[model samples]
Target: MKSITQLENKKVLVLGLAKSGEAAARLLAKLGAIVTVNDGKAFEENPSAQSLLEEGVKVVCGGHPLELLDENFELMVKNPGIRYDNPMVARALEKEIPVWTEVELAYLVSEAPIIGITGSNGKTTTTTMIADVLNHGGKSGVLSGNIGFPASEVAQSVTNQDTLVMELSSFQLMGIESFHPHIAVITNLMPTHIDYHGSFEEYVAAKWNIQNEMTSDDFIILNFNQDLAKELATQTNAQVVPFSTVEKVDGAYLENGGLYFKGELLMHADELGVPGSHNVENALATIAVAKLSGVSNQAIKETLSSFGGVKHRLQFVDTIDDVKFYNDSKSTNILATQKALSGFDNSKVILIAGGLDRGNEFDELIPDITGLKKMVILGESAPRVKRAADKAGVTYLDAKDVADATRIAFEQASAGDVVLLSPANASWDMYKNFEVRGDEFITTVERLKG
Candidate 1:
């Protein structure tokens, strides 16, 4: 790790002690910062708070007392999930304190060059692929950020020879100050996290901030298909490398049924192990990162040809009696479900969808939902999803939960049909998370296999 002294002797507040916050608090304390840890959970129940207190860090728990802000902190490291409208955060901003997520801390200390990836969808898959490609080409790529790993923790161990492949969210990006990536990627933007960002424009602006500190020596890869991405290309100080699934671009693109980078055919689209045009877009972006990272074309092709889809992300479960079942529980938005539905023959799909009501209409799913063989809906958003199916003239059934939905979809499927669980809303309404929802679906499918 680089020995940085910017945070030394700084009085910092670590807000909302999730994994990211705890890591940041410890790191800050070690950096000679007078770190004060604050969390909403009670002191008795919070292990992170207990442990930090043992380490000589100040712990304030049970609630976010507004008076804690009176400590005159120089910086505040916030958890990405905490909204900016939060009283503590709002107060800090009002006081002119620099608010940041652990991402900024990771960037400050890491000896490794970072490659940040963010988008409404495909971030996990694209981030994973870039790491795999880089590793296969004899480079060390440490996967971190929102792909179920904390960059702050990972950065502590990364060497100068390593590359930090980070999967960033707009929430994380919103807190960043000087956290610039060597190669930044905006996979594609869709309307998401509107509740957290307050608007789509703000959400896009937050994602665009990944390149805010980038210089001309840095690279910013963009999706040419997105008009906003194209517009952003004209604004960034970094060199722009555009990728497209539809037409050829000067950067990575699809042409003549093959994936190419700067006109050199890297691999054919058919050779990719993962299904869906969405993955195709993901691969194109991965190609840009691989080529820029000095990875050989062979490594890129090998990784793409063998990479099965990410777990709970359009993952193929089981083919029971010739009926294929796909678990896509990670799809928590209309755009995600749209991409999932587009990967299959809509007429042969028994689509299981619905979850938390994010107050967004399912109108976007109309085109993909039009001809599904059967639609099984559940959770708080069931009625909303059903209304979309109804408008599409498709038959629908109501299920009690994910397992029940899985069974209903299977019962409605015919030989050669696909039973896909691509809920178009967040899993919070039904399950703890998408992974739990996906596991239940997979376990139920396994029972059917018996």
Candidate 2:
């Protein structure tokens, strides 16, 4: 394990004072790193910022001045909320100072092996599934990420023999220099976080950085069904293993209602606790990582058999009037929402969408909304969503909040209808983050039941 004592007296600049950023700053300060926490937003005006300062963190809020960063620093750790093009980051690059994401910083001190998962969609599900598989494989101390926990925070508390699985965002990948994973994953790429990266290509580049930095000694797992993932494999030097749900895969596949790895049957479909075709793909990635990690077949089956679905990825809440309410607030991208839409047979679905604009175009799903009964728009991006829904000639309405949207959808719903909260944009304009946004939606729907 890397010694925390080695970072003593090291001058570290921690960017953005969110949970990950604040966690990084606190840990660094405890390790004796002279940490200065900075946020592009204001401290007095933002409660989150104010809390960080109240906790005794040296804070530079309401935008960072480049002059404040001119001095030599050992390292800069940034939150996933900070994109690569931020002015401070550009300046940091010019100065040739090492910059890392919270995940990278956590790994530097973790004795546990990293199992990284990234994709435009399904990252959270895949990460959780992989962690479950590792735990079932009899590897104790299984954590999502050590020190930098979104779900991975448990990694820091576990023993070295434990396995660590990380759901990495592109923002996290952007700042890494030499961070490598023992088992890396690309669930499948699609357009996401386009507003931050300025373009889809740039976003893809940041995601590809994870595999690009790995050597042949490290293994890469990807979905063969993703054409772009196949193309990306050719560009990287790592050994590529592929998995698919719709067809036969070289590394893993689904057959006869069961999941198989290279002709080796690992699990029955009824054994897996997760549903949807995407979950099947997630299972494959988990099994492949398990195989490479020397996990036994029986262990993999046992782990998968008892695993439950993630919080906001197509989570089933309750059925009211035969209408299934699914909380997929975690699907903050058009591609992710599209995947959620694909999970069920199109009959009557009320898709509650709209949030902070993330440079996304909704035209891709317009032609495919044949079964969409209605669409409700809410939050900062409501106007944009209404515009797209109007163009598609679909029934659309603007709601004040998630509750309003749910109520409207309920009034318009029929038996066997599906109420889906899959906002294809960030939640910052109206809420603290996606988790809050999702919780609000779930609470609203449950209230309707009463």
Candidate 3:
């Protein structure tokens, strides 16, 4: 493990006061680094900044001042959510100062071999599944990173014997200098977060950064079903292990209703508790990770069969009057929503979609609207989605928000139909995040049940 002493006496600037930034600042201070934290949120609004000030660390709140860069800081730890276009970040680049994310700090200090998972969708489910399978197999797995808990928090106590399973976002991956994972898995690649990265190519490059420091000794599990992932195989130095739900591959594949590893049966595909064909791909990726980690088939099977799924990703909410409600608030992109829709019988589905406009066109989703009983649209991108629905010759209605959308969907849904809240865009337009949007949907559904 890289020594934390490397940070001692180093001048470090942490941008943003979010969870990752706060964790990083505290950790850096604890490691004896001279840390300065800059956040756009005011000091009074950020208790984290106040707490850091008490620790004798410098706190610059309310906004990122360009003058702060004059401090001649040796390194900068940036929150993944902060775009590279930030003035301070641009200045840092101009000065040739190294900018790193909390993920990099976590990697430098962590003693365990990290298993980083990234992709447009299924990251949470795949990460959770890997950890569960490893734990069941007698190997301890500590979950962290984009799964909510900052990796810096988990890195402090992680041992070499333990496996650190992380769900990494493209934003986090973009800032890494040497954050290498022993087992890296990209479930699948699709156009996502274009606004953040500025373009599809840049977004793809950011996701590919996960393998930048990996060696041949490392394993990169990819989706063989995805052509982009297959193309990525040629670019990585790590051992490429492909998983597929389509046809048999060298690594993992689904055959005759069974999941197989190198032609050996691991478990029955139907036995997996998670619904959807997309999840089968997730399972395949997780199975590869489990097998590589020395997890036994029995443990893998047990975890797969018992694991209901991660919250907010096609989670079954309830059934009212024979109509089922599903919460897929985690579907924050068109590709994700399309996959969610593909999970159900189109004729029996009433879809609630639309959210923050990420400058993404909904044309790709037009064809998938086939057989959808109805579409309830809302948020910033509702009009764009409605246009696509119109082109598909599908019926739709606009609601003011998720609550109104839920009510409309429930009213429209008939017995035996499924009400799916799978907004094909981010939740920033109306809700704090996808979780809040999902909780509101779930609460609304429960009220309907009452």
* Candidate 2 TM-score, true structure as reference: 0.66
Error of 2 at 257 (Å): 3.6
lDDT for every model? 0.88, 0.76, 0.87
Expressed as tens digits, the lDDT of each residue in 1-450 for candidate 3 is 446688889999999866678789988988889999998878875666888999898999998889999999999999887789988999999999999999998998999999999998778778878888899899999988876568987798899999999989898998898898999999888887787898989999999999999999999999988888888899989999999888789999999899999989988988998767878988899999999999999999999988765569887676676577889999999899888875555656889999998887799998677557899999998889989988876799889998999999988988557899999899999999999999999889879978
Clashes of each: 0, 4, 0
Q: Give the clashing residue pairs of candidate 2, or none.
A: 144-152, 145-152, 146-156, 149-153
Alpha-carbon shift of residue 52 in model 2 (angstroms): 6.1
Give the per-residue lDDT digits (tens) of candidate 2, residues 1-450: 456676788888987765566667776776678888887766654454566667766788888888978767778887766667788877887888788877766676677777788887667667767766766677752545311243323435655787677778787888777677778999888886777888899999998888766788888998998788778878877888899887887888888987999998887877887656777888888889889888899988877776654567777656575576888999888888887876443335788999998766778866545336788899777777777787666788889888888889888898546788998888898888998888888888779988
Where does the lowest 10-residue lDDT sum fall in candidate 3?
339-348
| TM value for model 3 | 0.72
Arranged by lDDT, best first: 1, 3, 2
Scanning candidate 2 in windows of ten residues, the lowest lDDT window is 145-154
Q: Model 1 over residues 233-348: C-alpha lDDT tens digits?
A: 99999999999987889999998889999999998999998767888999999999999999998988998998864679887666676577888999999889888875454656
